[model samples]
Target: MSSGMQRYTRRTLAREILLILAGLGWLFPLYLLLLTSLKPDSQIFSAPTDLPTSLDVGNYAEAWSSADLGRALFNSMVITGGSVALLIVVGSLSAYTIARRPGRWSAVFYLLFVVGIIVPSQLGLIPLYSMMRSLGLVGSYVGIILLYGGLWIPMAVFLYTGFIRAMPKDYEEAALIDGATPFRTFWRVIFPQLRSVTATVATLCGILVWNDFFTPLIFLSGTDKVPLPLAIYEFVGSVATRWNLVFAGILVALLPVLILFVVAQRQLMRGFSGGIKS
Candidate 1:
């Protein structure tokens, strides 16, 4: 091989090694959490560094029951799923309209959504809490779903708008020329092309909604309504901490996001690239 090519290969290998090391460094905490969760209470403190000689599945079972993780998981699934679905549907339609027909009204509405992205949700917490209480929505699935949908709309719409603008107009024009209705054209031709963006939005929003702690903590006062993050918070008490159970609860909470990332990683990357290009 040429000397230049050899040097380039060496540099690439070095970069790969560095990235692997960095990835392992980042994952070390998760490994420790997994190890801690698998250990008994006695083993947790005494031999915290020691790898488990044999996996102890009881901690997982205990953690599940103690934290009511099953119920929390269901609640999180319902809220996150509903929020993502609504965001995709609403955000996509809004974005498509804005992209296809950019006028003063569309621009104004889009600007409002852009402004929302800059404003922190914490600023509205007090009013939001009062509003929820007045509406009798606190501790209700519908309340959290609405909050997630509203909070995530700005970013979702922004991403979708960028993606839709990048899409070719030829397909829509052809569909119209072929006697297709506007709705049918968008549904059949335009929407399929947006799969990458849709996956990106869903995965990103799903992760955020799934891992959200503050919203659930403030709104889901009832144990039954608590999502995984809030449910995991219950593992700690006023006087002491249940480290084993806490770690176990964390692992349980992490599983869904991890699985989601793995499944949607390719489309997520594509969507990001498409969004940036757009």
Candidate 2:
């Protein structure tokens, strides 16, 4: 082989080795988590780093029943699903309007949303809690759904607006010329083209909502409406010394989000590539 080809092959081999090492490094913690979870308390401390001799599936059952994970899982699904759906609808419409309109008002509104993304949600936490409590929204599914929707809509709008602005207006114009109403044009012609961005928004916001602990803890604490994160948290606290059970609870909590990412990974990649290309 030529010297240049030999050099190229060596470089590629070195890069592959480095990537493999990095991937293993990242996965080490998860490996530990799985190993520890499969171990009993007696083995967890003694052979902490060793692989399990036998699978301890009881840890999962114990953790699930103790944490009431079934209910928490249901609650998480409701909140995450509801919030993402609301965000897609409102955020897309808002972004579409802003992108299609050319005026100072549109710029101002977009700027406000940008600012919203920058601002910390904690700043208004106390006031928000007080208001929700007064309205008897505290500890309710509707309350948490609305809060998450409002909090995440700004991010969704920012993403959607950028993608929409980069998209061509020909489809929308053609729809309008064909006697379609603005709403119909947006839903039928424009929205269909925004699948990538919508998927991006949904996946991003869905993960955040599903994993969020603080908001649910604040609003839904001491209630049966707690989501997976909070439920896992409470479970951990109760079983603090039992690392095996704690890990089992955590693993259970992680499954749904992991499954979601696995399912949406292709769309997620397309969305990211579309955003960059735009």
Candidate 3:
């Protein structure tokens, strides 16, 4: 027993050290970006990894004005929010149906959607661009929101399916016997129990849509339609390589995801673990 305990202790110590190192490695990029944002432009390139001598917030102010962040933030927020909302409705409903129905055709339908995850979005870029152009939906918020909705649906559906599968059918049956219609049963009873998985879906899909640059770059050429990622790209180009300002813009761009993670991290973790276990 003593030998076994010693071995376990050694293993746990090693694991903790490895995890700490990995955590630091993952945070290095963010640290560098913040460091750059605080440094003077002369010091930015001189020693990129050196700690900033002072916390100068002027870079953030410059980024805000020069990047037209007001419009960009609004566009990104609207698109990301709309896309996540659509995914929650469509993905959850489809997943619930697939879970409760449970037949060969349902399996096939789920397979068809799950298989989409294997197909890289870049592969469909040209066709997607052409489709938007043909439909006269290019450079519009609704078009990009719809595009994100379709692209994000598969993962959300997959998550919701797994989570819904784990749910007790007794509650659903009880609701049915209580004279609650199928739709009402879902909204009133089933959907409320899905808080964890739904939060996970919303956060994951929101972050993806928020960070996406290429889709907007291809479909949205107008300044007003451009999201934060594209706005930052254009700002960098116009600034003639002022990396201090660039880092500031990136930091600002990361704020929403950071805030969301800080607030909903517990829910996100529960969602993923509960989903996988179910």
Candidate 4:
């Protein structure tokens, strides 16, 4: 090979090796977690680096029964699903309007939601909890659904707006010329085109809502109302004696996200690419 080509090849090889090492570093903890979870407690600590001599799945059974995870998983799905649904409706509409129409008033409205990206939800916990309580929404799925919806809508709006802003208005204009109302034009023409951003928003906010611990802890304390994260919290406290079980529960909790990432893996990345492909 030419001298310059040889240098480029060497550099690519070095970069690949470095990335492989980093990937291993990130995955090693997960490897350890699975390893520890499978080992019997007697062997967990004793054989820290060694592979489990035997796989014990009793820990999973104990985690499920002891922690009431099945119900919690269902609740999480509902809250997450509801939040994403609300976000899609409100965020997509708002973003499409803002993207298609540019004005001082529109700018102000857009800015209002954009600012929410930085406002930490922790800061509003006090009044937010009070409002939910006043509305008799405490310990209710709808209440947390609204909370997640409200908190995440701003982020979704931001993403959708950025994405929609890049689109040609020709499709919308053509739909309008065909005598469709604005909402119909948006629903049939514009919204359909926003699938990439919608998927991205759903994935992003779904993960947030599903993994959230603080919201459920504060807004809903009933054992039946709690989601997976809170159930895991209770699992840790109640099953402290069973480290293997705790780790097993933790591993179970990670499965949804892992599955989501695997399933939407490509589309999720594309969504963030702003629907712009080379």
Candidate 5:
């Protein structure tokens, strides 16, 4: 092999090694969490650093029952699923309109959304809570769904708009010439092209909604309505600073997202790459 090629190969190997080490560094805590969750409570305190000598699945059973984690998981799924669905539909429609029409007022409308992104959600939490209360939606599933959807809109819209704008106009123009109505053209022709961006948006929004604690904590009053994150918070509180149970609950809570990432990782990477290419 040429000297230059040999040097390039060595650099590539070094980079891969560095990346592997970094990935393991990030996963170290999660590995510890998983081990702790499988350990008996007695073993948790006694052999904190050591793996369980005997496998015990009882801790998972205990954790699941101790905090209505099952219900919390269900609630989390509903909220995150609803939020992603709404964001995709509404955000895509809004993006298509902005990209195709570009009316005199389009810039103003887009600017408003851009400004919304800059405004922190915490700044409006108090007023938002009062509004939800007045609407008689406190502790309701609809309430949380709407809040999550609304809060995520700005960023979702921004991504959709950029993706839509990058699409070629010829496709829509040809559909128009072929007697397809505007709505039909958008739905059938252009919308399918948006799959990559939509996937990226869904993955991002799912992660955010799944892990969110503040919204559920503040808006949900009943135990049954709380999502996994807030349920885990309650779990920790009940344990009175028992790190074992806390870590166990956190591991349980993280499992869904980890599974999601593992399943959708390829699609997620492709979507991001496609978006950047466009």
Candidate 6:
């Protein structure tokens, strides 16, 4: 018994050591970013990984003003929020229909949405751009929001469908039996039970939309309403990139998404775990 206990304890210690190493590896880049952002231009290349002797915040202020981050922050927030909201409403409704209905057409539609998940958005970029340009939506907030919605709604629907399929139909049936219409039942009875998956969708979609640079770059070019990523890109010049300011801009851009993940992490886990099993 003593030998077995010692072996188990040794294994646990080794596992913990490995985990700590992995965690440090993951955090090393973040540490470097923060450290680099604090150093002056002269100190950056000389001591890239060294801890900053002083907590200089000038880089942050300069990056913010130089990048015009305030307007970019608002643009990103609105676009991300609007896209997630659109996904939740449309994706949930579509998934509910697919899950509850039993027909060849329903299966076909579900298959199409699954195919959408597998297909890359870049495939149709040219045609999509042309269409948006023709519709005069190329530089508009509503256009970008709608574009993100179209790109990500498939993922949202896929998640919702799986969760809803696993769910017992009792609540929905009960609501319908109580004279509630299908739409009303979904809103009142089913959606409340979908809080976990909703968080998952919101977090996943929000992160994607928030960090996406290519779509906004193409669609929102020559416009003042660029997102955070584009604003950060301003620090990257062809001749000389300002490492300190670039790091500061990147750190600033990351804060909102980091806060979002921290807040919704529990729900994200629950959603990934398939929520309440019926």
Q: Assess every candidate by TM-score.
A: 0.93, 0.94, 0.95, 0.95, 0.92, 0.94
Candidate 4 error regions (>4 Å):
275-278
Residue-level lDDT tens digits of model 6 in 1-278: 79999999999999999999998998889898898989877676766777777777998998888888889999999999999999999999998998899799989998898899899999998999999999999999999999999999888988898899898889889888999999999999999999999999999889999999999989997798899998777656621556888889899999999899989999998896783332
User: Across residues 160-266, which tens digit of lDDT does each residue of candidate 3 receive?
Assistant: 99999988899989999999999999999999999999999998888889999889988886648899999999998898878999999999999888999889899
**Residue 254 in candidate 6 has what lDDT?**
95
55-167, model 5: which lDDT tens digit per residue? 67776777788988999889998889998999988888887787777887877777887898899898999999999999988888888888888898887777778778787
CA lDDT of every candidate: 0.87, 0.89, 0.89, 0.86, 0.83, 0.89
Between candidates 3 and 6, name the one with more favorable lDDT: 3
True-structure lDDT of candidate 1: 0.87
| Cα lDDT tens digits for candidate 4, 1-278 | 89999999999999999999999999898888888888887785565578777899887888888888898888888888999999999989988888788999889988988789888889999999999899998888889898998999888888888888888889889989999999999999988888877889888889998899988889887648888999999888886666788888888888998899778877788887883321
Clash pairs for candidate 3: none
Model 5: lDDT equals: 0.83
Model 4, TM vs. native: 0.95
Candidate 5: list runs displaced more than 4 Å.
Answer: 273-278
Worst 10 residues of 1 by lDDT: 233-242
Tens-digit lDDT string for candidate 2 (174-269): 989999999999999989988988898899999999999899989999998999999988988887689899898888888887788889899888
Off by over 4 Å in 6: 2-8, 275-278
**Candidate 2 runs further than 4 Å off:** 1-7, 276-278
For residue 132, what is the lDDT in candidate 4? 88
Candidate 2: count of backbone clashes, pairs at least 3 residues apart or interchain: 0
**C-alpha root-mean-square deviation, each candidate:** 1.8, 1.7, 1.5, 1.9, 1.9, 2.0
| Model 6's TM-score against the true structure | 0.94
Q: Model 5 reaches what TM-score against the true structure?
A: 0.92
